[model samples]
Structures are given as C-alpha cells and as structure tokens.
Target: MKAARIHAYGDADQIRVEDAPIPAIGPDDVLIRTVAASVNPVDWKIRRGYLEKMLPYDMPLTLGWDVSGIVEAIGADVTTFKPGDAVYSRPDIRRNGTYAEYVAVRAREVALKPTTISHVEAASLPLVSITAWEALITTAGLQPGQRVLIHAGAGGVGSIAIQLAKAKGAHVTATASQGKTALVRSLGADEVVDYHNPTAFAAARDMDIVFDTIGGDTQDASWAMLKPGGFLVSITAPPSAERALAEGKRVGFVFIDPNAAILRDLAQLVDGGKIRPLIGGEFRLDDAAKAQLASETGRTTGKIVIYTGQP
Candidate 1:
C-alpha cells in the first residue's frame, strides 16, 4: 500500500509518499480501504512535532485522523459493520492514520458514512464536525434561543460549528474576514463580524457561548464579548481557569475524543438536510504535503480533502 508518511517531523517537505506494509488490525479494529481523508490544522501541527509531548507518536507516522472509507475487513470482536460497508471516523490520533490506501481504526470509532454525500465530502466531516459537536453540544450545553459566537467561521471547525449551533436553534454570530463573511452567513451564522475590523467584536457582545478556534489575542478578546455567566469553549487551548473564575464565567477546553455515537447523529443531520460538509480543495494522496500546506495557510473557506485513488 502507498502511504504518505513523515519519518521525522519538520516541514511539509518531509512528507513522502511511499510503499508501506498494510496495517494489521487488532480484535476490536476495522481495516478500512481508504477512499478519502481531510487535512486539519492538527495534521500540520503533528507534522511539525508541535504535539510531541501531548500525542507522543512514533516516528514514520502517517499524519491524518479524518477518514471516510470502505471497510475491507473487521476484527472478530467487531459486529457493528461488515466488509464493504462505507464508514467514516475521526480515528484515534495515537495510531497511524488515514493518509494512506489502508488504515486500521477501532470499530467503535467508525460510523456509516452520511448517505447524502460522496466519500470526499464525507471525509471532510468527522474531525471538524466532531470537534464542533463536542464543543457546542457536549461541553458547552448550548441551549436553543441562546446566543453564540464562533471564531474563524470560514475555517474547518468554525464552519461546521456555525451550522450545528443554528441547527440547535441558537442565535449564531461568527467572525471571518471581509471576503468570507458571506460564506459564514450562508452557513447559518445570524451575524458575521469582520475580524479584521478593529471594532468589529463590539457588535458581538452579550453572547451565551463563545467558541474559540483561534487562541492568543482572539481568545483574549472573546472574554469581553460574553455575558457575565456565559461559557467560553476553546479547541485551540485551555481558557484560563483563574480568569473564568474572576470574570464570573465558565470555560472548557475540548480535545476531540472520537465518538461514533456523535458521528451517527451528525450523519442523520446531514441526511436530514440540517448540516453539510464544505470542501475547500481536494488533492491526490500523493500530494498530502500540499494539502497540509493549504491548511497551514489558515485561509481556506472549508475543509481540504485528500482523495486516495483506491477502488
């Protein structure tokens, strides 16, 4: 099988598409013949060794977590899916991932692909959708009629977050550049704030929840936008516990823990026409490095997908 891997972490130049032995599965694993995968910021972050201490992956790692593929085989302990089943997952990041012709993922982490979309589009959903779902629904306990603000609304997680928040009947506000404001609004954001405009955030005040995808100055500024008891949820970094206490607000940091249950619910949303995956670009598996470079740019309107030319 051909896999794009990095033997040592560095730049996109270090990724090489080469032959690798097909992965062997454990008793609870499913062997998937990769159809498509998507690039997330974490893919490039892992490639650059930024997450070494947290993830501790071995060298020669295949760097992707978001996958949509056909099950080639399933472990003896796995009963939920069978050979030839189309499935999608944000697989556990500790293992070699879906940036290859084949990948082994835990059966419990896999869900049937959304029937409404192709594998390329399905591939774009798992990671970002799961992150958005967890942050908005699971962690924040966002309620209908509440106001919510999503940062980087044109980017991967934010794009999905906007739609999910709206599906939950929340009043959604989002931040994007001037050129992408229409895109964010189309995704169901009730208001789009141009992040480049210095005073743009003033219009976003009195939120019930603020989903922060960008850390540093952006996160710092978001605290002021929330109502006194509003929740600040971050996927980029942990919001300060002390700050939350001092400001009489709540904060939670989300590290995506793949859940097939959530994927199933997301699929239902897709099939029911409540949500959709947005593909910013597509690349051949051999061009995985290029995909990572595009994600690193932080300007993509949606997810970047990599199509593995496998039947």
Candidate 2:
C-alpha cells in the first residue's frame, strides 16, 4: 500500500510517499480500507520529533491520527464491527498511524461512522472531537446551566468543544477573531469573544469553566474568568496547578485516549444532529506535506483532512 511516512524528523519535506506492506491486524484489531483521515496538530508534532519523549514511534512513522473508512477484515475477537462496516476512529497515538491506504486499529477504539456525514467529514471529527470531549465533559465535569469559556474558538478542538458544551447544556463563550464570530456562533457558541482585539480579557468574565486550547498568556488569563471553585482545562499543555489553586479554581490538563466509548458517544451526537465537524480543507494522502503546512501555519478554521479515495 502507498503511504505518506516520515523517515526523519524535520520539516514538511521529510514526509515521503512510499509503498509499504499493509497493516497486519491483531486479534483485538480490525483492518480498515481507508477512505479518509484527518491531520491533527500531533501529526506534524510527531513528524518533527516534538513528542519523541512522550510518544516514541519507530522511525518511518505514518503520521495521521484519525480515520473514517470501511472495514475490510476483522480480527477474531472483534465483534463490534463486521466486514464492510463503515467505521471511524482516533487510532492510538502510540503506534503506526492512519496515513496509509489502510490502517489496523483496535476494535475498542473504532465506532460506526455517522450516516449523516461523508467520510471526509467523519474523518475530521475523531481526534479533535475526542480531545474536546475529554476536556469539556470528562475532565471538567461540566454541568447544565453553567458557563464555559473556550479559547481559540475557531480551532479544531475549540469548534468541537463549543458544540459539546452547548449539547451538555452549558452556555459557551468562545474566543476567536472578529471575522470568525459567525462561524463560532454557527457552532452554538453563546458568546464569541474576539481574542485578536486588545480588550479580549475585559470582554470575557464570570465563567464556570475555561477551556484553553492555546497555552501561554491566553491560558493564564483564563484563570481570571472563572468564579470561585470553577474549572480550568487546557488541552494545549499541562495546567499550572499552583496558579489555579491561587485563583481558587480547579485545573486540569487533558490528553486524549482513543476509546471506542468516546468515539461511540461522538458518533451518537453526530447521528442525533447535536454536533457537526468543521472541515477547513482536505488533501489527498500523497499531499500530507501540504496538510502539515496548513496545520503549522494556523490558517485553518477547524480540521484539515486527508482523503485517500475519490472525492
């Protein structure tokens, strides 16, 4: 199978298309005939060896994290899906990824793709959706009728975070460019704060939770928005626990685990028309370098995906 892989960790030029052996399935895994995969920030981060210490894949790594495809075969213990089932997953980050024409994913992390959307759109949702899900729901323990502020509202995790927060009955305040207000509003953001403006902090106040996708000063200011005992969750980096405690807020840093239960919940939300993925752009499997460029440049609105099949 043809795959876009990185033999060395460096610039985008490091990714190359090569013919590699198809992925072999384990007893607990399924082999998916790839239709589409999405590029998350981690794809490029891992490609450049930024995450070498935390997640060390062997050299020549296939650098995609999300897949929406058809099951060509299933392992003996895989009873959740059958041959020819359409599925999607945020494959475990610890192994070879979904940049190939096919991927072998653990059955526990694969779920039935939502029938309401196309493969490209389905591909866009898994990683970011799971990340947002873990941040807003699992980590923060958000309750209905509360307020949650999400930084980087136009981003992959922020876009999904807005919708999931709204779905869970939280009033969401999201930070973005003034031009992106409509996009953020369309995603169910109750309040769209323009972070590009000089008065961004003055506009965002009194929140039950702060979901910061951008770390740094933006993350630090999120602490001020929270009332006493509110939650602060940052997916971009680990939270400063001492600072959080000083501000009288609970803080958490989330790392996504690709569980079928998480994907299944996201799938059901998609099926119910509560959450929709925002697809910024797409490239073919051979165009992974372009995808990496889009991610690093930070110009994309939401997810940038790689389609392995015809449009």
Candidate 3:
C-alpha cells in the first residue's frame, strides 16, 4: 500500500510518500481502504514530533487522524460492519493512523458514514465532531435556551460545535473574524463576535457555557463571558483552577475518546441532516505536507482533507 509517512519528525518538509506493506488486522480490527482522510492540526503536531514526549510515533509514522472509506475486510471478532459498508472515523491516536490506502482500525472506533454527503465531506467530521460532541454534550452539558460561546467559531471543531449546540436548542454565540460571520451564522450561531474586540466579551456576562477551541488569550478571555454557575469547557488544553475559582464556575477539559457508541450517535446526526461536515480544501493524499501547511495557517474555516488512492 502507498502511504504518506514521516521517517523522523521535524517539519512538514520531512513528510514523504512511500510504499509500505498493507497493515494486518487483529481480531477486533477492521481494514479500511481509505478514499479520503482529513488533516487535523495534531497530524502536523505529531509529524513534527511535538507529541514525542507523550504520543511518540514509530520510526516511519502515518499521521492522518480522519478516515472516510469503504470497509474492505473485517477482522474475525468484528460484526458491527462488513465489506462495502461506507464508513468513517478518527481512529485511536495510540496506533498507526489513516494516511494510507489501507489502515486497520479498531472495530469499536469506526462508524457508518453519513449518506447525505460524499466520502470526502464525511472524511472531515470524525475528529472535530467527536471533540465537539464530547466537549459540549459530555463535559459542559449544554442546555437548551442557554447562552454558549464558542471561540474559533469557523474552525473544524467550532463549526460543528455551533451546529450541535444549536441542534440542542442552545443560543450560540461564536467568535471569529468578520470573514466567517456568515459561515458561522449559517451553522446557526445566534451571534458572531469579531475576535478583534480583544474585549468583545468584556462587558458581556452570564453566558451559560463557553467552549474554548482556541487556547492562549482566547481561552483566558472566556472566563468573564460565563454566568456564575456556567461551565467553561476546553478541548485545546486544561483550564487553570485559580481562574475557574475566581470566576465561580466549573472548569472542564475534554479529551475525546473514540467510542463506537459515540461515533454511531454522531453518525446519525450526519445521516439525519442535523450536522454537516465543512470542508475547507482537499489535497491528494501524497500532498500531506501541503495539508499540514494549510492546517497551521489558522485561516481555513473548516477541515482540510487528503484523498488517498494508491497511485
């Protein structure tokens, strides 16, 4: 199988296209013929060895995190899906990834893809959708009619978060550059704040929930926007305890776990036309380097995908 992998992590320049033997599957795994895969920022982070201390990669590493493809074969113990099932997922980051023509994913992490969209579109959803799903629904417990603020509203996670929050009937406010206001609003954001405000939310208060997708200054500013008992949910990094206490609200950090049940439910949302995957761009799978470059720019409004067909 052809795959884009890094022999040693350094920069995007280190990425290369190479021929690798097709991976083998365990009894609990399913081998997918990847048609499309999206590049998450973390893919570049891992590619450059930023995760070396924590999630170190094998010498030759496949860095993609999102996969949308057809099931080519199933492992002995897998029964949830079979050959020809259109599927998509963000496989667990602990193992080899979906940057190849074929990958072996744990059966439990895979979900049937949304019929409403193409494989390329569905390829963009798993990681961001799951992250948003976990942060808003599981950690913060966003409620209907509540005011929630999502930073980076046009981002991969925020775009979907806005929709999911709206789907739950929450009144959503999102922060983004003026260029993306219409995009965010189309996804159902009740209000769009120009992040240029540096103090856009300074005079604002009583937000029931804040989903912080951007860490640094943006995460810090989310404190004042929340109501007294509101929840500040962060998917980017951990929240500061002192800050949470000073603000008098619950602080939660979300680390998305790939669960079949969770992916299945989210897939239903996609199939039901409740949530749509937003694709900012697509590149040939071998152009993983370009994919990584685009993700780091922070200018893209949504997911960037790589189409992988053994060439």
Question: In TM-score terms, which candidate is top?
Answer: 1
lDDT of 1 at 243: 97
On residues 64-111, what C-alpha lDDT tens digit does candidate 1 reach at each position?
A: 999999999999999999999999999999999889999999999999
Better of 1 and 3 by lDDT: 1
lDDT of 2 at 131: 84
Error of 2 at 155 (Å): 0.7
Q: Tens digit of lDDT per residue, candidate 3, span 22-137?
A: 99999999999999999888888888778889886677887788898999999999988989899988898988888889999998899888787888998899988889888998
Over 1-311, each residue of candidate 2 has an lDDT whose tens digit, in order, gives: 98999898999999998998899899999999989999888888898899989986788788898999999999999888899899999988998899889899999989999999999999999888888888888889999999999888899888998999999999989988899999999999988888878687676888899998889888877777888999989888888888777778799988888877888888889999999989998888888899889999876799998887543
In angstroms, give how far residue 194 of model 2 lies from its true place.
0.8
CA lDDT of each prediction against the hidden true structure: 0.93, 0.88, 0.87
Q: TM-score, each model?
A: 0.98, 0.97, 0.97
Deviation (Å) of 117 in candidate 3: 1.0
Q: What alpha-carbon RMSD in Å does predicted model 3 have with respect to the real structure? A: 1.5
Candidate 1 deviant stretches above 4 angstroms: none
Error of 3 at 83 (Å): 1.3
